[model samples]
Target: MTVHPDRLDELVRAARAGGVRGVGRRSFLRGASVSALAVGVPGLLAACGTESQVQTAESCTSEDRSAAEKALVFSNWPEYIDRKGKKMPTLEEFQTTSGISVTYNTDINDNTEFFGKVKDQLGGCEPIGRDIITMTDWMAARMVALGWVQELDMGAMPHVEANLKSDLRSPTWDPDRSYSVPWQSGLTGIAYNAKYTGEVGSFEELMTRSDLKGKVSLLSEMGDTMLFMLLLEGADPEDFTEEQWSGALGRLEGYVGSGQIRRFTGNDYIRDLNAGNVVACEAWSGDVIAMQYDNPDIKWVVPEEGLSLWSDNMLVPNKAEHKANAEALMDFYYQPEIAAQLAAWVNYICPVEGAQEAMEQVDPSLVDNPLIFPDEDFLANAYGFMELDESTRQQYDKDFARVIGA
Candidate 1:
């Protein structure tokens, strides 16, 4: 989920109430005018800096405090961890067993926003006061690219190596899995109120259908919505050229121009969707899965083009005082039993390989759920967005913000 800039974590409660859950493009318009986006988005990005231009923290290091500190702060999305009335069972057990004090903060409501908060401290080779921060693929890549994150000691994370799902093993940004490890995987696809809009099987229909016009929303995340637009334009998001990005951006501009898109949003689309104020929109598979438990009108569909596959990654920020303890926690969660336990409650794609078998003991029904345990068919249609270079990411962010009038 992208997020509301001011009250970024406001959607966190909504995400937890249902379940744990949890783009683009380029230029050529260099010759053209981006009056609205150029005008409206100047301040929207006050929270985020130019990611590509962020200074690399080549000198960042923290003292070995783990032996005595014996504590770490983990910032993850809201509702991502399992809770039993003020207690996160797995985390509590980890602290008890390992004798590590853990401070868990759910303040990471959006990738760009969180980066904005910590960039200054990180760039100065200082601490952002956290040991770990879990973020989506693109932002994780940006942090890794900028050297804002610390490298993991894979030797200490043997379970991560053995149990990490094959598909999530490598991201172009962290090709060697040195800086980032996936926390959970999810699919971004077409979601709609079946009772209102029928089947929105493609982005084209969602952006053009008469009934959906003025009643539809799209994700605020550039990668999620813009990559879908890239696919809608018959381009591969995993690898595409700037010319391809320009075409997709133009198409998106047209959607907003038509007023077919009521607003660009993060997970808050679910609220409007449930109220029927929105008939259809882009959505994440997990959010739809949680919504369906109460309302049958909710539907999730992989577009004819495919599903956008992404992961929220666990990364140790540079200068973290308890890197070793943080490594211990990461390793603990990688254990299939622990991963499956977290997955059962959150209902997102689990990143552990043996978690499916582990889920059998937890919930036999989830074993066959493609959303939880994706089969070959689901894999066939899932696509990951291309990892953008720094310059490209900076430009694309501006372009996407402009189009969404953020």
Candidate 2:
């Protein structure tokens, strides 16, 4: 999920509040901001006065010490794994089975913040001390573009080759799936508190309905929020033009200017939605699914325009010493049993093809949950954002931040 600022302090506090695990499983403590989370190091490029900071194996040599080290350093978002009493069942199982000790860190609260912490090291082809880092699509793409991440040995990951879902196999940035592996995937859709209003079926209704005016919050993430705008304009988000982008941005600007939209929010929208302070809003599917467990008033809808699909990918940064061990870990998780266990706890879309049947043995309750294992028809209308070059991505992000008042 994308995050935002203003409530950043709250985001930090929430991210660090509880002991090791931070918040509850599926808790809403995302820490992304529109401007800050826009693109990977746009501000850094401007500050460093660099045209590009690209690398390759020839330019930045890497070594695989997995045979000797037998250790890995991984970083991921808080409360993202399956946990019970401070122990991650799936992770512990991996360690026990693979014998690869992992130094798992939950330090990635926001994509931008994490990027800031590592951009300096990555740009200079130095080690960021991370074997596997989980980040949303845009950040992953940026790292891949700059060649800051290592290419995976797919030959070692047979499970991934056989079980990875078709839609997730070829992201534009990593079309051949050489560098990044998805940790988890999720969808962006509309959510309305039934206690506050009737079912809100479409994005258009969320924006233009009179009674919902000033009570609807759009997502702060550019791609998640703008994909629908692109769809509403009869344009394909996966391959839109500069003209299409401009038209979509202008339409969103009109909604914001007319006071039809309440505010642009990150995961913090969960609080406003729960309190009924905001009736209907653009929301993440996983967040809405988790909310429904406690508050039946929350309802998620696949907007008429369609859904925005994104994934938090697993990447091994350049200079990570445990390349083979990291590859081992990636392959281990792709096993249908392990993937189902993770999906049962995280409640996001499972990217493994055979995980649905595996869920019958892991957790029968989740066997039929669409959010966890959506069928082909459910995802037919789902769309991903168009890939952009760094400069163009930075420009679109700047434009998006301006419209969202970030």
TM-score of candidate 1 against the unseen true structure: 0.84
Q: What total of clashing residue pairs does each candidate reach? A: 3, 4
Give the per-residue lDDT of model 2 (tens digit) for 1-406.
6567757767777667753465455543343344465665776677876655788888898898999987999999866788887899999998999899998998986676678799988988999889999999988999999989999989999989898889889987899999999999999999999998999999889889999989999887788889999998899999998899999999999999989888787667889999998999998887787788899999999898899988999999999999999989989889999999999887899889899999999999999988898888988999988888899988998899889882
- Tens-digit lDDT string for candidate 1 (1-406): 7667656465566565644453112333542347656776877786686553354444565665898888889999876888788899999989999999999999886677788898878777777889989999999888887888878889989999898877777767787898888889999888888777688888878888887879998888899988889988889998898899999999999889988989877667889999899988888888788789789999988888788989999998878888899889999999988988888877889999899999999889898888888887778878888888888898999998998892
- The all-Cα superposition gives candidate 2 an RMSD in Å to the true structure of 15.8
Candidate 2 to truth, TM? 0.83
Give the range of the ten consecutive residues with the poorest summed lDDT in model 1. Answer: 23-32
Every candidate's lDDT: 0.84, 0.88
Q: Which runs in model 1 stand beyond 4 Å of their true positions?
A: 1-58
Best by TM-score: 1
